[model samples]
Target: MRFCMMESKGKRGVAASRDGGPWHVLFESEPGFPGTVDEIVRSGEGAFEEAMSAIEAGTAINPDDLKFLPPLTEAGKILCVGLNYKAHVQEGGMPMPTYPTVFARFNTGLIGHNQPLVRPTSSEQLDYESELAVIIGKKARHVSPERALECVVGYSIFNDGSIRDVQMRTPQWTIGKNFDGTGGFGPYLVTADELPPGCKGLRMVGRLNGEVVQETNLSDMIFDVATLISLLSEAMTLEPGDVIVTGTPSGVGISFKPPKLLKPGDMFEIEIERIGTLCNLVVDEK
Candidate 1:
């Protein structure tokens, strides 16, 4: 089942849409959809049983009645894997990594799909990265690749907005990628069972305006999702609501022949097959 957080009556709730219309509220703050999403995840195979019941009773909310929010409002931390895609490495003039390259983003960077990505006046090297983000359903550490799937709650899309100038200023990329509102993750979370095995063959595409700019398949990932999870768990504990952003494909601004960065007023969209599209507009920093 797809799960999202949306605004209804000035409060946030879990919802789903139908026919590309407004959001339908499934669970609210008092009822706590985040808690419900967690409870459903823990329920394993029976997670959607209640939602099904609601549908049968004709009490389910319609999709066209709510406003969207980041899929998870309160993940403990956002863990990101970089350079996992071979094409991205090639474009950046870097060699493929032997182990997963990791980084961290504070929750302050989090923003919802369709939200605005602020273009900082301090830097003019804005870029977009379309990636698949994995949400953890349970606490995990030192997990084996064989069992890592059990800790995943679902998958969502993330646009890892970057400022190449800031990123290249220092060897570390934290400052460039973690600016406020740079991280766009949401639309909804699609459960693991709902997705194909290992997310192999999935297509991730990014568009600037309506023109396709970056396109790649999950098959091109040097280190697939399962291995990344296992590798990460060995070093840090992955908690329920924790997020992991799989790396982006090539075609980022910084990799261009002369580097084409995003200016204020540009729009970007990241689409992952079987998940959903996350679209955001770039705006000048206030």
Candidate 2:
């Protein structure tokens, strides 16, 4: 099943897609998509089931009629896993991690697919990292890897936008990565059931304009989703609406023969099997 955020009547809402139209209103306020989904999921697993039923019964409008929002909004915390892809580590001249390397980005960096990514004047080394993003459906802490899958609501595409020069200026990546709208995530959230078990062999590809730039499979992950979540939960509570970006594959601009960076008018698209593609354009900051 696919779920998306959209705007209608000057208000943003969460919506489900069926027969090319939005069915079942999941949310009704701007920035409330994730929060609304969390409420439903918490109320019971049957909540979504009931919504689907209503849609099938023609009680909801079709999807083609609404404006879309990023599948997730208002996540309590946006957790990012770094160097989880073998190729990405090697390209960045970093050694394979013995443990999950993690970081965090604030909500200000969050943006939806197809939205314009504004280039910051502070840095000219903008780059893109295509990643598989995970959305949490339940509160979890100190969970076992075997049980971690139970907490995942679904997956989506994420462009871990970065400013390479600023990022490398310091060991921490926060400053370079937290620019407004720099992090592009989501077009829709695909339920875990829609993905294959283990997700180890799914294909993920990144393109600049129309050219394929990064390509790899989940099999290349140094720390798979389940283990990463289990490890993180050990450190802090993972709540509903929290997000985990599972790192990127190789081929970021910084790894080019001569580094390349995003400039105004650049476009990028990331496609992950089962989750759909996320496309965005770059524009100069106003």
Candidate 3:
């Protein structure tokens, strides 16, 4: 089942649907439905199953009637892994770290499908990093890689847009990666049941204005979903809706001979096999 959180009539609602079908609002924030996506996610896997059941019995709304919104809720954590791809590490001229290069992204930085990624006036080196994001389904802690996948509920695409100058300004990459509206996180949340275990062996690509800039397979990740979830859960509890952006593959703008910086009027897309494409427009920050 494909689960999504959409906005209709100015209120957020939880909807479920099959691929190529209209969405059914199982829970809306209006008067009679459940709360936000965060609330449903926090409610655990049972909520997801129940919502799908309801959608099956209810009527679905036209896709045009709803506006896409970032599927993440404020209560959820956004943990991103950087340099997990060998080509990316080599292209960025960095050593292959034995550990996952982890980073953080706030909800404020996330935007939905078809939205504009803001390029701040302070930097012209805005770059794009196409990554696969896993959404946690249950509580996890100190689990082994073998059983790590049990906690994942679904998968989604993420554009880890960055401001290179600011990202490299310090040893830590948080500041540059946190600019508002830079994180493109939505379009759809494909359930785990619909894809191969750990979403491995899938081809993931990033296109800038119709040109393929980055491309790789999910199997190429230095640390797969199971590994990252197990590792991160060792010290911190991984709860439902907590998204782990596995890592972006190589071919980022800065990795080019000169650079391929994104500017206003440009379009970018993150596409992965099985999962759908997530496209966004680039616009100047006002």
lDDT of each: 0.77, 0.79, 0.86
Q: Predict model 2's lDDT versus the native.
A: 0.79
Candidate 2 C-alpha lDDT tens digits along 14-49: 667544444666444422234345455454455655
lDDT comparing candidate 3 with the true structure: 0.86
Which stretches in model 3 have alpha-carbon errors above 4 Å?
A: 19-21, 26-32, 57-59
Give the root-mean-square deviation of each candidate in angstroms: 3.0, 3.0, 1.7
Ranking 2 against 3 by TM-score, winner: 3
TM-score of 1: 0.88
Relative to the true structure, candidate 2 reaches a TM of 0.90
**Lowest-sum lDDT 10-residue window in model 2:** 26-35
Top candidate by TM-score: 3
Pairs clashing in candidate 3?
Answer: none
User: In candidate 2, residue 84 scores what lDDT?
Assistant: 83
Tell me how far the alpha carbon of residue 137 in candidate 2 is from the true structure, in angstroms, after superposition.
Answer: 1.1
lDDT of 1 at 188: 83
Task: Tell me the spans in candidate 1 whose CA falls farther than 4 Å from its real position.
Answer: 17-23, 27-65
